[model samples]
Target: MQALTDLPSLQQVAASLTEYWSPRVVAEFDDSYVKVAKVHGSLAWHSHEHEDEVFFVLKGHLRIELAQGAVELPEGALYVVPKGVEHNPVAEQECHIMLIDKKSTLHTGNVTTEKTRSLNEQLRPL
Candidate 1:
């Protein structure tokens, strides 16, 4: 994993971002990755077969649209999308988020979209 944060301030890193829906790797912990992203609009509907994805709202708001229900997260809130659950993340305006995902997790799970990000691309220096 790559990051500018030796003494990483999540807010500062989030503020430095210039891309939408692009998540940058910030650190690695055991079998999981710590990533940050600025997002707007909707990501494709997808599901991770076995990996649980955790999202922490750093700024703005987020809604995790699930088949059964949608989870709303305001800044400082967090939500976890359990394994095998189909979900889509949506933000009406710009939002910053921190995510914790397993090493084997794919950005868009089983679905590939224009917004999908590869692990190598995410691992690039932050």
Candidate 2:
């Protein structure tokens, strides 16, 4: 079994991330997955068909745009986007965020925006 001390710091892990719109898996469990992503500008407008996605702001603010209205999630705030709800995520500047979702969930649901990315991909330090 691995020890907690063997794990890398979030800052250390964040430093190795080079690409935008791609998330690096940090941890996983039977029911959920955790990923760290660096986001800038805007993301695709999409919704999960079967599961809700939780976004936790780790470094900067994030704007979640919904059909009804938009909500700003500042650092340390957690927002959950319910399933089947259309929404978009936008970041004015570079921001680090942690996402929690179900094991079978996709990064983007039915929407085929430019930011759509594959799921469960491992991101190693370069």
lDDT of 1 at 56: 100
Q: Please report the candidate that would top lDDT against the real structure.
A: 1
For model 1, the run of ten residues with the poorest summed lDDT: 1-10
- What lDDT is reached at residue 38 by model 1? 93
Put down candidate 1 lDDT per residue, 9-123, tens digits, no spaces: 8877878888888889999999999999999999989999999999999999999999999999999999999999999999998999999999999999999999998998898
Which candidate tops TM-score? 1
Q: Which regions of candidate 2 are displaced past 4 Å?
A: 1-3, 120-126
Clash numbers, per candidate: 0, 0
Q: Per-residue lDDT tens digits of candidate 2, residues 65-109? A: 999999899989999999999999999998888888887788777
Angstrom error of the Cα, residue 102, model 2: value is 0.6
Each candidate structure's TM-score, on Cα atoms with residue i matched to residue i, is 0.93, 0.88
